[model samples]
Target: MSILLWQIEQHLENHLACRFGHLNYCSLRLLQEKDMVQGLLKLQESEKTCSGCAIGKSHRSSFDKEIAWRASQPLELIHSDTCGPMQSITLGGNRYFLTFIDDHTRMCWVFFLQHKSQAFNIFKRFKNMVELQSGYQIKKLRSDRGGEYTSLEFSKFCEEMGLERQLTIAYSPQQNGVAERKNHTVMEMARTMMHEKKIPLKFWA
Candidate 1:
């Protein structure tokens, strides 16, 4: 037993020297404090150029907070986003879904699609349906500058309808928080319900 324990300690020491020595002292200390890792005491602190560590530690500055825009009436401003190409296709063959949120009412609409190219048509249908029901014109449309939203046909349609287009800055989803958060909420709810019910992946539509 003593011989086996000594061999294990020796192997751990060798592993610490070869694989974990380059880690910062703080990380070594964390490993020592954790119950899952053994032999952290044998690790030696050393200054090493670890590119992965440097990159992992780097982050973009937080975006400045601003007063959120509020709509005076329904259909005044709408936020939209698309999420998907899920790992499993739905029974309806849909692998993508789009969401639209009315700013004033906080009302949400979801549309399923097989391809992203259907986004423009779906938006058109949503606009007509809502406008007809509420008797209010859509004044503004807000979304990320995805290809589906920025397509020539979509742009022309919005222009003809006199709708203001609000596109978030490149790589900045926070600017479209309403739609982004709605998609997150929808996905999380779907995942939770599916998990609890043991629903099959193909029925996710």
Candidate 2:
């Protein structure tokens, strides 16, 4: 065990995915199959769990499943989320990111921002671009009660456009599961890939 640990530490990026990358079992296997990793083919079969991964990934108890409602057509519903104040600024000087997902198609769009205040403007641009390209008017927008979404101007704009608003209950992220899960998945993949490539953190943006 000691010798194996030493070997992995000596070539961490090339040999392992758990401790340094926080990658889950599925990601490790997928990367391995793609020949994107090397030198630790035996490690994945270990019965012991990776403690570092457990500690880093620990989360609160799961919530009940999402509501039974589903969107039937594109532009019928949209899920939006913001994630940010990252530990490191990206090479592009971004500190945060926003995501918009079409509930029906599950198509996602991402926009980078240097400040949270930029969310509203970026959202407008996203709306215009997507509506133009998809040839569909957005019928509803769903998001948490963030200041960007709650602002008077934002509310008025939505009203004027006849877009229904669906705000999640306070402190209840599970109600906005679509956007929340998308953000989590995107960031997790980015972290794992960056670690695998030994890429600099600043490029994460």
Candidate 3:
């Protein structure tokens, strides 16, 4: 026990607020055998209840598993998401913005729509634009299992083109975290830009 006293001293010095106290007979003897003399001495001063220790030692919920996608060229795999029904509607009665993001280039396209139903047509326009410019058909499409993505027209169009529709499991946004996070980031950036520039928030459409 005496030989390991230095190690106990080193450990206790850094985490002073956290100390083991009121050890059972077995634990105390075990510590003694390990030469944890410093910790033993400090334990006398430690309060029975420690807020810092409780907060630091509390268990946290595990994070969901993340999806890994191999990098692809522009128009190869597009992430589509919608953000909307903003509290403050635009003058044009726009309530939402459909976003199309290229997986490889990270370039984004925004289309303002008054209803969620417009997502399908907006996707069509995005497809045409990407195909014309990049000369590549989208080989894969990824989105959450939103009603918009499951629409018959959208599914049929994707099937006919031999495109793989990768819909995340219902209610699991983390599975499509890239697009979900992009929507959040864009909203934050748009808010900051409006605040800094003194532009009307409704123009975010």
**What are the lDDT figures for the candidates, one per model?**
0.78, 0.78, 0.69
* Candidate 1 TM-score, C-alpha based: 0.68
**Candidate 2 structure quality by residue, lDDT tens digits, 1-205:** 9999867754554345544345555656665777765653634352334444344345534445687788999989999999988999988889899999999998899889998888878878888998999899899999999998999889998999999999999999999888998787667656655655667879986
Residue 85 local lDDT, model 2: 83
Instruction: Report the number of the highest-TM-score candidate.
Output: 2
lDDT score of residue 92 within candidate 2: 85
Question: Candidates' TM-scores?
Answer: 0.68, 0.71, 0.65
User: Model 1, 112: alpha-carbon shift in Å?
Assistant: 0.3
**lDDT, residue 11, model 1:** 63
Clashing pairs for model 1 are none
lDDT of 3 by residue, 140-161 (tens): 8889877888999999988988
TM-score ranking from best candidate downward: 2, 1, 3
- RMSD (Cα, Å) for all candidates, in order, is 14.3, 6.4, 15.9
RMSD in Å for candidate 1, one decimal? 14.3
For model 3, the stretches where C-alpha displacement exceeds 4 angstroms are: 1-67
Clash pairs, candidate 3, are: 1-35
